[model samples]
Target: MAFFTRLFRPARASERRFSELVGPHIETMYRMAWHWTRNTHDAEDLVQDVLIRIVNRLDELEAADKPQPWLIRVLYYRYVDLYRRRQRSPVLPAEDCAETGFAAEAESSVMDKPDRLALAAQLERALTSLSDDHRDVVLMHDLEGFTTAEIAGVFGISEGTVKSRLHRAREKLKGKLHGSF
Candidate 1:
């Protein structure tokens, strides 16, 4: 059994290191995944798939200066891949995501306020109305607090382009929300 133990040691070490390197970013990954997927089950599956894909790339991940952007980029690509796959073959109907669900989770502490819930629901609707690229930029920069440079890096776009997208996204959101309030 010593031979088997020796054979698996590297795998064990790799798993430990992957957990250490990845644990800190799981919540961020989940949040981004949730933003893209809009369903809890899909979000969890996306995160899991990303993690599985990256398990063999722990060396590159470890060498990164900041892993969050790298991780988010990978997650974004995986989401895009799944999106494209779904486009090619419409196996499942898109979920009718509750407009209030996203906002409700964010405003859990203030659930008693009807105005807050209403605003949250409206914001959710407005968010869903934005195009995918614009919505991503808005969520990463405005909501997740990632800087424009980081987002540009993730998407392989220029900082100016990211800023432009963000501006356009915010303007669209404002227009959608203007009549609601």
Candidate 2:
């Protein structure tokens, strides 16, 4: 009876603990998801799905943990899943996506104007052209400004590898943006 009761109502203290500990990082989770998806709509959907998983997986987290790395792990795995599904399909008709209620208009767009939008589109193209390792490292570390150590933790790669990827990615972005590639 005590076990069931505890299960039903996780100690009030635990909720407080989780919020105090991980709440601040929740925005990072959303940004991580958004970066991976490349569109606001898909990012929001991805983050929403991850939110459910994070809630379910909270118990697996050690007490007094930072929760950022674990949250990145969730986002990374989900992005992998999403990347696979995208490769298999390659394209989804607008009607199908809308009919299935799988998309959100609020989060999905390429710029709305011509000149500025063109540059943004070019930037996205450059980003997608990168290898996954480089793209992930750059997204988390350079664009989002995660520390070398934090990025290493997020990608399960060495700090050396993260630094290497960031340097290479910067070179690549420069060439691509300058039309020198």
Candidate 3:
């Protein structure tokens, strides 16, 4: 009995520690996931997937002092994997997408402030127009307030590449928004 108890004690303690460390960042992770997925259901699914991955790799995460970037990196990679998988699959018919109601919600959300909402919609369109790499860099650095170094870390690239991507992304956004305004 003593041996069995001793063997399980550390595992339980580690699980508790993991939860404590990760609990505070759940909302942030969900927001980031939502930005990437652009829908509540997909965002929740993505966050759930990320949490599962983190829990599975809890041993490796024990040494991580700051887990936000690590968590974001996991989320980003998961999104990319899903994106690739989606590309390989056949597109669903329009009827299949009717249940999501994403378009109706989007339109209603913007109805309150016509000018600002229009501009925001334009910006979202521009963002979606960007290549995935450029869009990720821009979103991480600008909207999420991550530094170039941190963005590089998240993407596993150098700071110079991050800066270059960010610069080009901003230029592309500027061109897209210029015509709108």
Worst 10 residues of 2 by lDDT: 98-107
- RMSD each, Å: 6.4, 8.0, 7.6
Task: For residues 29-81, write the lDDT of model 3, one tens digit per residue.
Answer: 77677777777678777877777777878766767657878788888899889
Instruction: Give the winner by lDDT: 2 or 3.
Output: 3
lDDT of 2 by residue, 29-117 (tens): 76677666655567667766776666645577654255677778778888889778877995862432342111232224633545555
Put down candidate 1 lDDT per residue, 1-181, tens digits, no spaces.
2322232233577777877777767888888988988877788789888887998898899998888999999999999999889889958766755634567685776688878878888998899899989999999998888999899989999999999999999999999999997
Off by over 4 Å in 1: 1-13, 93-100, 104-109
lDDT-superior candidate, 1 or 2: 1
Show the colliding residue pairs in model 1.
Answer: none
- Pick the winner on TM-score between candidates 1 and 3: 1
Candidate with top lDDT is 1
- What is the lDDT, from 0 to 100, of the residue 10 in candidate 2? 34
Worst 10 residues of 1 by lDDT: 1-10
Q: Judged by TM-score relative to the true structure, which candidate is superior, 2 or 3?
A: 3
